[model samples]
Target: MQHRFLLGTRKGLFVVERTVHGWRSLPPHFPGLQIPAVLTDPRDGAWYAVVHHGHFGTKLHRSADSGRTWTEIASPAFPPKPADAPDIRCPMRGVTIPWSVELAWCLEAGGDDQTGRLWCGTVPGGLFKSDDHGDSWSLVTGLWNRPERAKWFGGGYDYPGIHSILVDPRDPTRLGVGVSCGGYWVSEDDGATWANRSDGMRAAYLPPDQADDPDTQDPHRISRCLAEPDVLWCQHHNGIFRSTDDGLSWKAVPPPEPSGFGFAVAAHPIDPETALFAPAEADVCRIPKAGRFVLTRTRDGGKGFETLTRGLPLDEAYDLVYRHGIDTDATGNRVAVGSTSGGVWVSEDGGDGWMPLPVRFPPVLTVRFV
Candidate 1:
């Protein structure tokens, strides 16, 4: 079987196919869209993409026949303005509606009875549920009306931003997501009410400026494993952590180095025991390992860590991988990583070594197998 890969970059959406001549890139599906997400919907056999749609906001497009044709889905629609706050009066504080959705899912893989519903996590951070497979979406009021959430968000009009949304593969109703300064939240009733899931997570790693508030306490950097639902893992600024009971509780998993923070974590699809992460010395600096680039791995569930940087660069490495920028192919044999430095590397032998892919894509944000 031939497996295609999609790369979402700041420039646009790129497709890579495996042919006799090796990997080749097709023309970007939406040029200059600032595409963030490119995913395949198993329910409708369609490819869905999210892109920045100019001043109007981010837009969602769907391709029914692979990447041939696309139709815009009515999303990124912000709520209406209240009578008290008119645009003309507050021209300096002009409010632009957010039309772009952050993350999208087909919900087919979610192990719930209610499959086929399209789910999206957006900025300004709220969950959107679509019953008609992404044709349209309605914001879930259950999460939007949380009384304590406002107070927890520092009483600001703009509380936080959502980066990752994970719907339990075994039970879709049970979902978990990570917010920039809001920590982590889980919903057991399929997008209804959510409870904070940051018991063992720490705020010690927060930067000097944001360390004064609740942002550090939040699980600012988090990721979930599909192979082991009970074993939820996150690579935060503080360190790494794993939950045995599916986010009910957590324990710290420190990296090899004490001063650095990790951004990306990739779990083995079949072998839950094996996982990979990229740790950088500085959050702003993208150079892997401060010029000594490395991808660390753990086989015994974070008990011990080892450096795996054979083919990666050690000098003048410009880009560092982000949280969502690393992933494993379906076969579980190949690992791929993208960087803010505008390069993509593939490791066929599990992180033993990595080689650059054929295409010269832009700073890659997320990579997924199709």
Candidate 2:
């Protein structure tokens, strides 16, 4: 399949396509603006971009003509804290968790059965659902109102955020969310109720006695297989984990080469036992291991990994792929990855090899195939 990409970068959002002559980039949208999240609705070809303003806060924009123009829409907002509600504080920074949206970290379209529906995951751990496209949004209190949220502290940011939202293909009401330092949560009634499901995910950052606590485990990113809905893969803070039962529980995959300590995991579209990862130095050092950047793929459910580095930086490399920086096309044959260093690469054969894309860019925050 011909591949097109939506690269949400620190400077703006870019739409690029692979064509007969060469890869071509369309005029960028929201130039020089930090676009942290973006979504291209497969349902109607509508595109959505989330912009973060240094002084004005977060905003959402939608484009129906493929980025030719955009219209601003309502961004997600936390309901005013109840007048009598108890104070909730962040454990990491020792600050009160504000009832506001700092950033819209991720966005996804609802299943086909739910027309005009959209799901937006925001920082401060709020999930918002929109029924009229981006016209309006209502906070999903099922996951938010849980008492466990009080313990959800920051992982990399001062406030915890929900960066991954997985909607089951077979059941529209069944949703899975991945929160940094908040653990994984599942809802079965369309965001009316939720259950923490990060059992077996370890947290090395915590004391040994609390290392296995489900409520505090940080999942850098979680992705489900498009062809096998129940299977999911996670690149966690402490290590790599896999969920064979729709994320109700997880089992750590044996450590892969270089390191298993990075963000970005892409489950193969057709193979439940296959997925891709970008490994990096963890904790204090978040760059590529030993100054070499590479991609790892597992064909047998992480039993082992084969590192792919055909076109990647192998010396003095400092690229780090964010949680949303890598993606795979529907056929699982084409893969794309962007990094903090503004480097982009594409693999046309299941990551067997890669080639750099011809473009200079700002740090890429998120990349999604369109």
Candidate 3:
């Protein structure tokens, strides 16, 4: 069977189809702007893409009939501004010409029903919720206005800037959001309130000299996997951790190998005992050393790991994978990785062997198979 892949590109949105030979990219979905997130709903057969409009703010486009035609969903919660406002990032200078939406990104379409809810996260970020699909939205008051957050996470440098929003696939009311320096937060009552899940996380306030620069060190990142509501696979700069009692507590899972500068973590759709990740340097340039790419899987609940590098390119010495870019298919038999060097590799035999797809996508920012 052939599959359609929705690509959120730097310039615009594109669709890729699996042909008899390989994948092919279609024309741009919209005129200009970067598409940071795209969702292909298997249930309703709708396509939704979020566009970053620099300072002008963000836009959402939806197609009930696939990519044949489109319509824009004017953001309902976007803080209204004067006609010639500055930008989304800097809204003071009356900057008319739009600026590059500097990563004030959003991850849309979450919740149990998977049709009515969509969550958006932004830089200096605030959490916004939309229950009517993308028609309108409202800020999650508790998360957006945490009293102690400004002091706890540092207002300027350590403040919250969201990158990922995960709602329990099994129970959409329970929500989780991943922030840059603030770490992770969880909401049990459908985002009515949030609690920090960084208890086991290292919140080291490093001095300039003592700091492990994200560029040189592991960037002290945090990523999560929710294969089960009670069990979450979390990866941090220091090590890998597992939360058995939801996000309330955590236990450190021994690194599969010596190298643990992990960027992403993915749990198989059905196989709870199985998950995958890519290893890289902890510092600024987290490239794989000499294309030494390996897909590490833990079969016995992080007790032991097996490496799958069968068809992965071994020529380059360093093969690095970044955070938020690895994913598993519905059957869990196939896996794909997007590299900083702009490489895409797919494994159909459960990560034992990989097939290099035909398209050379831009340095892959994220990969999702649905």
- Cα lDDT tens digits for candidate 1, 190-297: 888888777777665445655434322444445556677677767765678777787777788766652246677777766666778887775455455547667788
Cα lDDT of model 3 by residue, 1-370, tens digit = 2265565655666565667776656776764566766666655667777777766666777788787888887453545445674333222222231212234455656754656777777655567777776788776768855643442231112334566677677788887776665567889898898887655544234455634332111223333444555666766666676666666666667877635657677766666667777877554447664457666888777898887777777666455565556766667776777665656777776677887756655555556664
The positional error of residue 181 in candidate 1, measured at the CA in angstroms, is 1.5
- State the lDDT of candidate 2 residue by residue for 156-243, as single tens digits: 6778999999998898889899999899999999999999999989998888999988999999999999888989999999889999
Candidate order (TM-score): 2, 1, 3
Runs in model 3 lying further than 4 Å from the true structure: 27-33, 54-57, 76-104, 112-115, 151-159, 203-227, 317-320
